[model samples]
Target: MVSIGEFGSKIKENISRVIVGKEKTIERVLAVLISGGHVLINDVPGVGKTMLARSLAISLGLEFNRLQCTPDLLPGDVTGISILNLKTNEFNFRKGPIFTQILLVDEINRTTPRTQSALLEAMAERQVTVDGRSFQMEKPFFVIATQNPVEFEGTFPLPEAQLDRFSISLTMGYPDEQSERKLLKGISDEHPITSLKPVSGQDELDSVLKQVKEVEIEDSVLQYIISIVNETRSHRDIQLGVSPRGSIALMETARALAGIRGRRFVIPDDVKETACDILSHRIIIKPEARLMRRTNRDVINEIVESLPIPINNEKT
Candidate 1:
């Protein structure tokens, strides 16, 4: 069996074939996915943000599906419809692309809130409900939803409820010159994604997620988690604070980070390192604050800087 670190390294290399030079983005995606959490890739078009989602799906030996969220798109379109099978004299449920292992929900904000709500249930419960019936999803289910950061026109902003459903939100900006040059030269009759293969099958992926749950953390880490969340609640730059669910995600992601590093225990660095990604998007900024030129990134940095570090890592 491949070690957890080797497992992460192998998967990173597999996706890098198509998504050149964004190792950090690739690693975060892997960490959140293996941690049994969802991701929101925030960036512009033509940046391989969508491609990264596709590459990860391909590398994991999972069924991949892409939903181009648009104004006319409806909840039924994403969750599929319950149609009557005349021959069988019954209504059989035909599942949508969301039923797959990796669902690349491209341009998610373009669709109306009604359409977006279709995913809230599945994303949170790992199941879909149609005709008042709930169906369990396959193992290793993940949602790598991507959105355009610059375009808000005609875009329906995701509700805080929907946004909170995601575990971590990140951006994949333009790669450096070296990676862009490599992308151009590598194209022949095949795209880089075409030749990609899974590093390990679904079974292996499952084992890694199971191990991530077992990663331990000390009491100091728990206190650190509380302090960070508390800061978000009292910070003057924001109106709303991180929700309880958001705090839970932070702890789970921290543990997963520790496991991926081949350590059985988590440290303050893990929480501190992933704090921005894990908690930034969950914050609700006031309109006045936005007018005053404060970004969530800025507030996150301030909160992180103000916190005192743990003197000694005490075990729980």
Candidate 2:
């Protein structure tokens, strides 16, 4: 049986064949996946956001589906609709792209709020309701949603409720000169993604997730997580704070991070490292603070720095 760290490393190495110079970003994405959480990639266009999602799905040997969200996209389009089958004389449900193991939602913000709300149930509950009937998604169901951060025209910002559904929100910044050169050369003939093979599958992924849950988290670390969450609620620069769900995500991602590092126990650094990605999108800053140039990331940094790091007595 492959260990969690080995499984993670194999997936990262496979993805890197296509996505260059984003090792840390890939690791964070894997961490979120191991924790059974969805990702929101918020960045400018042409940053390999779609490629990252595709690479991960290919590397994991999962069934991948892409949805190009638009203003005309409807709830039925995403969750599927019941159709009358004249031959059978009854209505039959046709599954949508959401039925797949890995779903890539491209330009998610371009869709209207009603259409955006359609994903909320599927993402949160791993199931969809169509014509008063619910359908459960297959195991290892993961969503990788991307949006352009600088564009607001014809884009409806995701509501806080929907935002909270994503475990981590990240950005894939432009690659450096060396990485870009490598990328250019690599894609000149054929895209590396085409040759990428699955290093792990659903069963191995399930094992890794089980290991992540078993990664020991000390009492102090638990309190540390709570402290940071509490600070978000009372912070003056923020109008809304992270919910208990955010705290849970922080803990789960931290454990996954520890497992990725080949450690059996979580440390303060684990929580601190995953804190920004886990909590940033879930927070809402006040209008005055936004005017003052205070971002949610800035507020989260403040909260993280203000709290004391928990010291673990046992060696990990």
Candidate 3:
């Protein structure tokens, strides 16, 4: 069996073939995968958000499906609909793109709120209901949704309920000068994703996820997580704080990070490292804070920094 680090490294190396100079971003995405949670990639256009989702899906050997969300997209288009069959004279259910293992929702914000709400159930329960019948998704179901941060004309901002479903929200910023030059030179002829192969299979991925749940988290570290979450609720600049789900996400993501680092137990550093990614999107900033140009990330960082580090003997 391949070690967790070795397996993670293989996936990263495969993805890096197409995505350049975003190692941390890749790892955060992998952490969400291992934690069995969805991700929201919020960035400007042409920053390889779609490419990252595609590469991860290909590297994991999962069935990949892309949904180009637009204002005209409907709930039935994403969750599928039951149609009458002419041959048998009975209704037959056809699965939509949401049935795939790795679903990339491109420009998700472009869709209407009703269409966007269709994904909430699937993201939270891993199942969708059609015509009063619920269908469970296949194992290893993961959603990688991308939205353009700078565009709002035709986009509907995802409600807080929908945003909370995503375990982590990250930005794939513009590549550095050297990496950009390399990207321009490398993709001139053909895209590297065409040649990419699966580095790990479904069974191995299941094993990794199982192991992530078993990673030991100390009491002190647990309290540390709670402290940060509690701070968000009482903070004057914040209107809403992290929920119980957010705490669970933080713990699960920290465990996955520990597993990725080849550690049997989680440490304080893991919680600190993943705090922003897990909690940032779940928080709602105050209107006053927004007027002062305060961002959710900044509030999360302040809470993380103000908390004391838990003492643990585990070595990273």
CA-lDDT, candidates in order: 0.87, 0.91, 0.91
The C-alpha local distance difference test score for the whole of candidate 1 amounts to 0.87
User: Model 2 over residues 85-136: C-alpha lDDT tens digits?
Assistant: 9999999999988889889999999999999999999899988988888899
Worst 10 residues of 2 by lDDT: 185-194
Off by over 4 Å in 3: 314-316
Evaluate model 2: give its lDDT: 0.91
Q: What is the C-alpha RMSD of each candidate to the true structure, in Å?
A: 1.7, 1.0, 1.2
lDDT of 3 by residue, 242-311 (tens): 9999999999998888888888888899999989989999999999999999999999999999888987
Worst 10 residues of 3 by lDDT: 307-316
Q: How much does candidate 1 score in TM-score? A: 0.96
Can you write out model 1's per-residue Cα lDDT over 56-109, one digit (the tens) per residue?
A: 988888898999999999898999899999999999999888888988999999
lDDT-best of 1 and 2: 2
**Residue pairs with backbone overlap in model 3:** none
